[model samples]
Target: MSDDHENQYHYTPTLWIGILFLVLFSISGILHILEALYTRLWFLLPTVVLANIGEIIGWSGRVWSSQNVFANTPFLIQICSTIIAPTPLLAANFVILGEVIRRLGQKYSRLSAKAYTFVFLACDIIALIVQAAGGGVASSADTDGKDPSSGGHIMLGGIVFQLVAISVYMLLATEFVLRYLKDRPVRPALVAAVGPRTLDTRMRLMLFGLGLSTLAIFIRSIYRVVELADGWDGRVISTERYFDWLDGGMITLATFTVNIFHPGLLLGRGNRWFGKHIDASGTSSRSGTFAEDATVVEPKRDNGPGAKV
Candidate 1:
């Protein structure tokens, strides 16, 4: 295709939508950084901040592309940033699950809480690397006037890998939910030792926010898989409407969702840094940091009647 022809429809990203996303991401990123600082949630700081930064850069690239669609620099920036942005957010989600399991009790989980965090985090890192590499290769191909199919295929591979990892995580989460429901009744001795335990309002909100963000990311991932299936020149890839709704809209919503219901707010200060350390005697240790022990304690709350911890 001629340069103009190639740039005509496929290159035309909506200017206003790009600006909107840029503003949204910028505001959200700043808020997340502020929250992280205020809450002292060091564990969550890096991922949340980095993910928001990626969104900001990605949307900035989109805005740049809207101005000059034929420019390779803006195009590459948008592709790389947008593809990699959600990976860290997904990592944050995985990390929080570990804390959730820790607060509830490791016995309720199939894998240890620490394992849940690291395993999925490793997968997320791999996915990020693969996608970044693919974007690099694709950009090089485009610049060199070579067919971009190889790079597109590589990107697709990364996306598929991410999808699989996310699917497994969803299954694991579902299993934990089922297990929690099935094992609702506390053992008499355990109750006697620790007093009655129940899920606090904050904890419930955290879980709900996590689920909503996960679903949003999941939907965005599925959309990417479909969009990239036909390679660079695919119908879906050329359609800005799909990009608006699936790519920009879904991710923006996910980021905002997490920001509004941030772990710092829900889990409370110092809670994210520590885990509930239970010994062989079934006694729980509320003291100790994550580096010192593999346990996480539930945030202290007043136990009301009929509450389930």
Candidate 2:
């Protein structure tokens, strides 16, 4: 476990991947900021931007490292990026779970959404701090890769905590879907819009996608814990380059996919922000229409021959 070994894990990304991720981050940052301002959920905005910034720096470091394998700056940048990447994921989870809870209604859920948000976010914060501190301590240690004091244990603990939080989220999501499916109430309005079977199919797809996102994050957390368990001496731990692809690249792709197929944004024509308000009788002054009363109407169920059961 010499400095040479740690330094050997250098990577240089091709320009396209780096550029694409940068753009993705920029957009993500803007959305988070807009939400913060419009909705007053401010604490989440900087975390989104900072996470992406850290990632960009890490990618830049890789580009630099390609020029000089032993470059300390790039190594530092990449390590710091790894340390901070999960924060944004956690933040997205917070927002997503909250919206899901509100849409599904709090009374139907087994766990209080607010309480779950607080607990998961608290754990996420503690994990971030621990990982950040461990990265600092480990990176500062000698070439032998030995920080007998706190680095290894601290990093491992952080990963464990992250895994725990992610697990709880997945469980909650699964429970939510199960309860919804079991107690599903057919709304004539939904049937009229898309036909009953099609509407059910769409609902199932949306729930599945939401569930898959939670699982993807869980998988990423597990990979990290395994990667860190060996304390830089184990094969997996020493192979930082592999972790970059499997953990970093794959997880980013997963998250991007999650957003792309997001139920709130893609499933319906209306604004997701006002989805929960749909049933309210509040009227729009201009259109004289109830805010949430708009309905979807399907095509005629019978042909000109008028076939009927």
Candidate 3:
């Protein structure tokens, strides 16, 4: 098991492809950072920005591999980066969903807002750690001139776990959406306009973006599970087209989703200051947190579209 350029990445990574993703992820990352700062959503800085960094590094490794395809270091770096890149973005999605539920319909949600954060983040962390450990193990084994199948198996297990977690999460999200629609829970009225538009439209666009991002990630996860199933040398891994579409393309779509339809548009200004009171017209002033769950309590007196306060 020499660490030569033999069949390591299966094919010479196209230089343009690597460069393209590098630029795309970089743009998304920059936009996300700017958006996070404007919205005071500091939380997104770590999650979305970190994922973008990983993708950037991974594709840079690919670009390096294009020049030196026989090198072990670049190949290992790319593989590891590509595998773990999406986990942080997935975590960001979880946070967004929790916030959406908190702002839109807390009573309709089955768990507290914090619960979704805790559970899904825990799952994402586990997947990330497992995959990272597998990469380390594989890199170590290659250095030691030992077989890397064990590490491949570990990576496959991690991907499978991720797939299961993502599926369960989607199911829960679907159930929540169903319950919300069936119950027709009253959404808190807009205390003030969200950027001169109604809250519903912004919220709807945010929801669509989240859904699109989640679906892209899920599709990528499934592809990864299959890619790593037959222990590194599988047909899936041998193909560049699959990785391009499933991995690079999917992440591109997911990352841009936030950039285009950032939740900040719906959150509006004064999102970080926790104790500010907003006076929704026709309603009493009430203190609202960044989540704005308090609006449902006091600030929004009338839930019906045309009801008198």
In the range 10-77, model 2's lDDT, one tens digit per residue, is: 23444455555556655655654555465544444455445656666666666666666665656666
Give the least accurate 10-residue stretch of model 2, judged by summed lDDT: 286-295
| Tens-place lDDT digits, model 3, residues 1-309 | 456747587788999999999999999999988888888778787799999999999999999999999888888889889999999999989988877666655555666556766788999999999999998998888878788778878887888898898898888777766655555333424233221112466767877898999999999999988888855777888899999999999999999998888877665543422233446563335353433344231223334566664
Clashing pairs in 2: 278-292
* RMSD in order of candidates: 5.3, 7.7, 5.8
- Estimate candidate 3's alpha-carbon lDDT, on a 0 to 1 scale: 0.78
Worst 10 residues of 1 by lDDT: 185-194
Task: Quickly count the clashes in candidate 3.
Answer: 1
Tens-place lDDT digits, model 1, residues 1-309: 124225623757888988888888888888888888898777656787788889889888888878888777777788778888999889989988887877776655667777778889999999999998888888787777777667778888898999999999999887776556455322333332334345677877988899999999999999989977866777988898888899888888888888998987887664345564447897655653332234456344335667675
- Quick one: ranking by lDDT, best first? 3, 1, 2
Best by lDDT: 3
| Model 2 alpha-carbon miss at residue 264, Å | 5.9
Clashes of each: 11, 1, 1
TM-score of every candidate: 0.85, 0.68, 0.85
Candidate 1 runs further than 4 Å off: 1-5, 8-11, 184-198, 276-295, 298-309
